[model samples]
Target: MKKLMLGNEAIARGAYEAGVRVATAYPGTPSTEITEFAAQYDEIYAEWSPNEKVALEVAIGASFAGARAMVAMKHVGLNVAADPLFTVSYTGVNAGLVIVVADDPGMHSSQNEQDSRYYARAAQVPMLEPSDSQEALDFVKLAFDLSEEYDTPVLIRLTTRVAHSQSIVALGQRADVPLKEYRKLPEKNVMMPAMARKRHGEVERRMKALAQAANDLWINRIEMGDTSIGIIASGIAYQYAKEALPNASFLKLGMVNPLPRKLVESFARKVEKLYVIEELEPVLEEQIKSWGIAAIGKEIFPVQGELSANMIAERIAGKALDVRPAQDLPPRPPVMCPGCPHRGIYYVMQKLRLHATGDIGCYTLGALPPLKAIDTCVCMGASVGMAHGMEKARGRDFSSKLVAVIGDSTFIHSGITGLIDVVYNQGASTVVILDNSTTGMTGHQDHPGTGRTIKGDLVPPLNLINLIKAIGIRHVRVVDPFELEEVEKVLKEETQREEPSVVIAQRPCALLSKESKIPVSISEDACRLCGVCLRLGCPAIEKKPGGMYINQTLCNGCGLCVKVCKFGALRRAGE
Candidate 1:
């Protein structure tokens, strides 16, 4: 049966058909839907692990127990799972193991555009790239087979366009493959120095065998066309190149790593001009050039952002396509939602002139104009560490003016270790956990603290206050972020402490919680146009020509603006 499916959804379907019994991932865009879709299948046990590292480990454990397992995450998440990723190559697997990594070339929803293909090479594992949803399904099943055949973990790489784009995929029947028997092989599974040395040699031999067989692999095939030019591309890049140069001879790569060196050389010899088309990094181009093949790549094409059909046509074909230019539109920067609970916390922090080291989440938007509260945003869980570092550098008096802002999900991901570091080192740091009741930025996936499983089954929620207290932080305060006065008081009190403390801004996400209060209004008769309410940066609060007014359509009636207004100008309707 053929059905329209996203690349991520297709991956899940592929895993199910490939006899994969376990799927795990931490919620991240361009890849989160893979595990979510997998969870819908009764045959597959799926979970949302606390972080990428834990997610990969869970999949590894499942694979060790003789179950076909898969783990998915965005490109950056790979860095967090790198420790196990490298070692897994040496230890191999008892059952098939697959890792799905989605790359965001244009930084559409990511911090960086680091390519995952490099990870495959660094780990000495096979990597597959798919052009569309159909190919995504086929490649994943192929990945599982290749993993078991070679006794090595396999990686499937996807880009933002391919992962999000929809296409027709032909469904297949699930293979009821029996689980392999698990053996207690310490020499094989354990990574002690002596055992690792033996396994490292085995990893090298397996890679050599894979490389030798690459040319015969069905996934790396050539399409004959005009011999004047040939383009070697993979994943979405192949799609773009195919659209731009339909008449050119093409070498479309499904297996990107273990790069079919002989096949590439043969393709290079067939055409007078050869171009390597890829996004972000020159992984393929650098390797082809290393093999003494003369290829045109990053010299003519850019190494930053995404490549397009227009760009390929203009650069390689020397003719610009008749594509219409985008119209000049007003710049719409991302902002906090009208009734976002995190907004009140940021506003209070800004009012107190506190420096906030932010982590990855919707709250990172606090660094933008008006609130301008966050001082630095590096990555997930970096906020706590950076905040502690700043305090130690400048001393306890300086810590009174600084705070680390992280979401509840993020705090659980990697921030807990940083918090522990502060207590162990005898440093004073104020950590603020924005408990928004869901992973807001990543489409509200449940975390451990959310008291639900990936399948939405009820589970015991991890209490944040108890966890913080157990971590040696004595002063832990929970405040409703909508109560601006209370949030401000707690923040001030926590930051003033000479020891490590935590202040949790507890509230459900505006989308998750229905608003009961009436939309706020501007009392123009009692109003002074002081622009204080505007400082809250709520989209609901707007400045009109005559006076500042509330945009009722945009307002959630949380009354954050009303609390900020000093002149009794902004008030909830009928209040």
Candidate 2:
């Protein structure tokens, strides 16, 4: 049967049909939906692990137990999982293991445009790139096959465009693949120095064989056309190239890591001008050039963001194509939603004029304008460590004026380690836990503290207050972040404390919490056009010509702005 499916959903379906028994991943953009979709299939045991490293470990354990396992994460998440990735190459796998790393170009929800194909090259693992949903499905099934055939973990690289885009896919029944019985082959699975040295030679041999096999692989195909211009492309770049250079010949490569050199040389001989048109990085261009072949890439094409048909066409045609002119719409940057629990905490932080070392999650929005509560955001758990480091370097005065804020999910991901460093180092750094009850940034996936597992099974919730107290934190307090007075009082008190302190700004995210029916409004007669309410940075509150207005639909009736107004100007519309 054929069905229209998102590339992520198709990959999940392919995994299911390939008889994948175990699947795990941490929630991250462009890659989060894959696990969410996979969870819907009854045949696969899917989960949201605490972080990428744990997720890969879970999948590795499953593979050791002779189950076909798959792990998924975004490009940066791989940085956390890299420790096991390189080692696993030498350890190999009992069952076929496929790891999906979705790369985000254009910084779409990412901090950086890291090319994950480099990781494939670094780990000595084969990598696959699929252009659309059909190939996403096909390649996942092929990845599993290749993984076992090569006795190595396979990496499937998905970018934002291919991961999110929809295409028609042919569905298949589950393959009757049985679980391979586990055998404790120390020489193969264990990575002692002697075994690792042997496996290293094996990995090198495997790569050479894979490269030779890649020349004949059906995934790498040559389309004959006008030989004057030949383009070598992969993933969404190939799609863009096909749309732009319709008349030009294409060497569309689906297997990108161990590039097909024989096929490349054959195609280059057929065409007059050779061009490598992959996106984000010149991975192919660099490799092709190393092979003593001349190609045009990165020099004329951008090494960032996405590639569009018009951009490719314009460059190929040597003139701007008749395309839709760009629109000058006012930029609509993403902001925290109305009645977001994090807002009140950030507002209090800004009011106190403190430097907030920040961590990843929705609270990162605090770094945005108007609030601007956050100062430095390096990674998942750098906040607490950074706060303590600053105290050690700059002395008590600076530490007293500094704060660190992190979300509940992020705190569990890696922030706890940072917190331990602060408490152990004799630093008087005040760390604020933005306990919003869910992983707000990554579409509210369940975490350890959320009282529910990814499979919707109930679990004991981690008590943040008790956890802090047990950590030897003398000043541990929990306050509703929506309560402005409490939030301000706690921030002021904690930052001034002599000992290391923890303030848990506890509130459910407005989107996850049961919402109030009543919406807020401005009393024009009482408003006085003071614009103090605007300071809250809530999208529900906006300015009009005659007076201030609140979008009743957008307002959650949290009355955050109402609490901010000293003039009794803002209130619930009914009140």
Candidate 3:
């Protein structure tokens, strides 16, 4: 049966049909839905592991037990899982194993656009790139087969466009494949120096066999057309190229790594002008050039961000195809939500003239217009480390003017290590963790601090206070961020300390406040015309001709405006 499916959903369906027995992943955008969807199938055991490293390890363990297993994560998450990933390549697998790395080329919900195809090459594993939802489903099933056939984990790479886009996919019946018997062979399972040396040779042999398989597989095929130009593209880029130049001969590669060199050479010979269309890094282009093939790639296409049919058509215009008229598009910049709790925190920081070092989260919106309080944002867990480094370089008094702001989920993700660095190094930077009780930046997925699992099972939440104290921090305070005076006082005191400190601005996300019964309203009496409350930047607070008004529908009753109002014009409905 054909049905409309999201690329992520198609991956789940593919795993089910491929007789997958186990699936694991950490919650990350463009990839989170894969495991979430997989959990719905009764035939598969699916879970959200603590982190990418743990998720991959869990999947690897399942594979060792002789069951088909898969792990999914966003591109940056692969960096965390890289340790196990590289070694697993040498050990191979008892049953089929697949690693799905969904890449964000345009940094859609990511910090960097590092290519995942490079990981496949570095790990000596086969990589598959699918163009659409249907191809996504097909490639995943094929990936499992290829994995077991080669006795190596296959990498299924998906970009933002392919992971999130919707397309029609033909469903298939689930095959009942039994687990292979596990054997206790230390020489094969254990990675000692001697064993690893032998395994390395095995990996080389397996790669050669896989490359030969790639040459004959229908996954990488040639489309005969006008011989004047042959376009070599992979994944969604192939879809874009097909739309951009319908008449061009094509070499669409599904196996990105260990590319079918023989097939590529043959395709290159057929067309006079060869062009490689891909996003971000020229992985295919560089490899083709290495094979002594003259091809045009980044010289004609951009080397950064995503590519669309419109972009390709425009870039190759006059040279290869006619230019299409530019279509009018609406402007939609990402912003903090209407009643975001981070808004008040950033507003207070701005008022106090504090230079803030920000971490990755919804609070990163503070770097945008209206507030603009955050000075520097590097990556996940960088806030505390960045602040410490700055303090050591510039001295205490200079650093005292800065505060490091990170989210609760991000703090657990990688901030704990940086926090430890601050305490051990004797740096006097104050770190404020915005505890919104959820991973608000990525669709409210639960994290280590949330006290809930991906499947909504209750788990003991990591206590940030105890963690801070254990890190040797003497001063640690938790304050409701809605109280402006309390927050300002805590900030002032923490920054004055000679030792590292932590201030958790504890409050549910404004979006989640109603579920927690946080207060919301504005009083018409005790009115003053002052607009200080409006400066908090909560969309709930608006300015009318008479005075500031609160939209009850939008307000989470977090009382951030009430704290900002000196005239007591903002108050709870009953108060």
Candidate that beats the other on lDDT, 1 or 2, i.e. the better one: 1
Per-residue lDDT for 175-210 in model 1, tens only? 997899999998889999999999999999999999
Q: Which ranges in model 1 have alpha carbons more than 4 Å from their true place?
A: 321-329
TM-score of each: 0.98, 0.98, 0.92
Candidate 3 structure lDDT: 0.87
lDDT of 3 by residue, 32-130 (tens): 899988988889998877678889999999999999999999998999899999999999999999999999998988888999999999999899999
**Please, what's the RMSD in Å of model 1?**
1.3
lDDT of candidate 3 at residue 297, scale 0 to 100: 96
Model 1 scores worst on lDDT over the 10 consecutive residues at 321-330
- Which scores higher on lDDT, 1 or 3? 1
lDDT of 2 by residue, 1-575 (tens): 98999999998998998899899999988899999989988889999888999999999999988999999999999999999999998888888999999999998898889999999999999999999999999999999999999999999999999999999999999997799998889898888899999999999999999999999999999999999999999999999999888999999999998999999999999999999998888899999999999899998899988889888888887757566767997778899999898898888888889998998888888798889989988888889999999999999999899998888888888888888887887889899999888988879898889999888989998887788777788898889888888888888888899999998888898997786658886778888888888878888888999889999889888888988898998888667
